[model samples]
Target: MAVLVVLLGGASVAARLDDSSSDSAFPGRPDDAASAPLGAPAAGGTASDAYAFIATQKGGSDPVTYDPCAPIHLVVDARTIVDGGMKLLEQALDEVSEASGLQLVVDGLTDDEAPEGDAVTGPDRTWLPVTVTWSDPKASPKLKGDVAGYAGSSSIERDGHRWFVTGTVVLDGPQLKRILDQRGGRAGVRSVMMHELAHLVGLDHVDAAGQLMRPSGDESITTWGAGDRTGLAAVGSGRCIPY
Candidate 1:
C-alpha cells in the first residue's frame, strides 16, 4: 500500500493530524521505501511526466477525500509565523489550491494550540476551518524525532457518507525554521507546507522521489511532480457537500 502519512526520519511512517479522532491514525501498512528512491527523479523529468498521486485501498470502499468544490478555511497558530511568516504558508496554499481546484480561505490567526491528546471543542470543533500550528517537541512527540510535520483530518458519519469536517496540521517549528534559513528558503518552507496540506486533503506519501508527497526532507525537489498533480486533481474533484 502507498503510505499516506508523512515521512519521519526519512522513514515512511504514519503521522496523525487529528489528535482526538481515532480514525485519523495512520492505517497499518508496509513501508514502500525499498520500492523507490528517496531523492530527486532523473533530470528533465517534468511535472507532466514525474508526479504520482496518493493510492487507495483495494476492494469496494469509498476513498477518503475532502470535497474540492467546497471552500476549505484554515486558521494558523500565531506562533508559527516566527520562521518565515504566513506569507510562505499562503503561497503554498495558493499553489495547492490552484493545482487541486480547491477553494482555500485563510481564517486569520489563532491561539488555539496543537499536538494535544484531547478532543477538539468550541464552535469550530464541529468541523469548519482546519487549524495549522507549529509545535515544539513537547507538544508533538513525533517532532522530537525526525518527523518534520503532521497533517490529517477528522471525519464524521453523516448523510451516509464519511465527510471530512475538520483537520489539523502541526509543523516542527525549530526544524522548519532552520531549513527556512538555509539556501532553499521560501521554497523549502513552502514545500513542507504543501506536503502537510496534501495530507490534510487526504493525500498519502509515496515512495517515489521528486513527488511532493514523498516522505523526505530532500529539498532538491521544490514543487509538485507529475504524480502529485494527478493525485491532487483527484482529491479536488470529490463530490460537493452543503456548507
Candidate 2:
C-alpha cells in the first residue's frame, strides 16, 4: 500500500552486509512493554475496527497497480526455512488470494542461498519473482527490534500500466522461531506472515488495532478483517495489463 516506501535500497546491500554483524538491535518501544506494529485504519482502537488503503505512484504522478489478470508468482528460499514453514507461507498466501480475488502460485524453491548478512536477502535483480526468505536481524535490520517482517515490490510501467514485476518478503527467523517454539506461537507466526503478504498485495499499515495490517503484531486477528478484505479486493481489482 505504501508505494516506494523505501524499506531498503537495493544498492544498500553491500554496505548493510558489511555492518550487519555489528548492527545493534532496534528494540521495540517501551522497554517494559511489547512494541506493536504501526499500520492503517481504526481511529482509536486496533485495526480490527478500522481499514485503510495504500496508493501506488507512477512517474511521481498517476497511480499505478499490479495486473489482476494473472497469478502472482512466488518463490521461496528454503535454505534456512524450518520444516513446514513454506507450507505456512503458502497457506497464508492462499488466504490473501481468496480475499483479494487474486491468484497465487508457488514457483518452487529458489536456487539463491540464504543471505550472509548482506543485501536484502532476495532476488539478485528486480522483475525476477516474488522472493520469500527467513532471515535474522543481520540480514534484515528492521527485524532487530519489534518488527516481525517486511514486504514490498519492484514496479515497471508496461503498456500504460504500472506493474509490480517483482516483490520480496523477509521474515524474522530467530524472533519468529522463538515465538513459534513457545506455546501458541504458531498462530502468531502465521498471522505475521499473513500481515506481510498483505503488504505485498499493496496493503499498507493502518492506525487501527484489530486490522491485520497493524504495525504491531496481533495474533488474535488471524483472519483478514473487513478493512483488510476491502483493501485486498481493491488491489486485486486493478487494471489488467496485457504483458
Candidate 3:
C-alpha cells in the first residue's frame, strides 16, 4: 500500500500520517497535450546552500514533488478564518508560485471537513484538491498547544517513480486570530501560511535563524530566505510526470 507522508509545521518533524491506505486506484494522468510543464522553475540557487527536503527519493537527494505539468488546485475552508486571512493566503500562494515556478490555483471554498488522515479521495473516488482549512485544536489535535499550522503532501509510487498527488494545510484559527490582533500580525500570519505552504511543496525546516523555514515562527522574517528559495526552486524543478 502507498503511505502518506505528513510533514508538520510549527516544528521540525516528519511523520507518516497513514500507512494502510491504498492509493493504487487513484486516477491516472490525463491523455491530452496538457502533459507539458506549465512553467519552468526560476533559475538560480545552488544545492550547496542551506536547504532540506521533507522526503527524498530512495538512494537519492531528489525531493518527491508534485507533477509540474499540472496545476496544483487548492480549496479553502474559511469558516474560522479571520479578517484579511484570505488576502494573506493569496499573497503567500503568489510568492510561493513565483519562487517555485509551479502554477497554483485556488478553486474557491469547500464545505469538506478538515482531513485527519491519509484518505485523498472524495465521494466520487477521484483525487481531492489540496485542502486549506482553518481548524482548532479540538478538531485537529495536531494543531494543539503552540502549533500554528501544518501542511503535507501525499505521494504514490507508480512506474517506479514517486509523485505528490494531494495534500492538506490546517491552520489553528484561535492562534492565528490572536496573532492578527497584535502589532505586525498580518506579517506574522503571512509568515505562518508561507511556512506551512513551503512544507506542502516539500521544503523542510532548517536550523538557520533568519530563514523562513526555521523550526519556530518569527514574524520578523517575512520572506523566503536564500536556503528556502534554493529548496523551492529544486522541488519546483522536479521531473514532470506524464502519468
Best-fitting candidate, scored by TM-score? 3
Question: Per-residue lDDT for 54-125 in model 1, tens only?
Answer: 333234344455554446778988664555568888898887887777766797988866434423333433
lDDT of 2 by residue, 99-167 (tens): 776666787988775334323223333234577888778866776766667876655444445555456
- Checking candidate 1 for backbone clashes, the offending pairs are 4-204, 50-226, 51-225, 51-226, 51-227, 52-227, 52-228
- Alpha-carbon runs more than 4 Å astray in model 2: 1-49, 57-63, 113-127
How many residue pairs clash in each candidate at the backbone level?
7, 24, 0
Error of 2 at 138 (Å): 1.7
CA lDDT of each prediction against the hidden true structure: 0.61, 0.59, 0.76
Task: Give the C-alpha miss distance for residue 236 in model 3, angstroms.
Answer: 0.4
Error of 3 at 195 (Å): 0.3
Write the residue-wise lDDT of candidate 3 on 1-243 in tens digits: 211112255222222223324454646564421567787766665544777888888678788887888888899998789899889999999888888988888989999775556666566655568989998889889887778889888876655567677788899888889888777788888888998998998888888856888878566788888888888888888877754
RMSD of each: 10.8, 13.7, 6.5
Residues forming the 10-long window of minimal summed lDDT in candidate 3: 11-20
Q: Which of candidates 1 and 3 reaches a greater lDDT?
A: 3
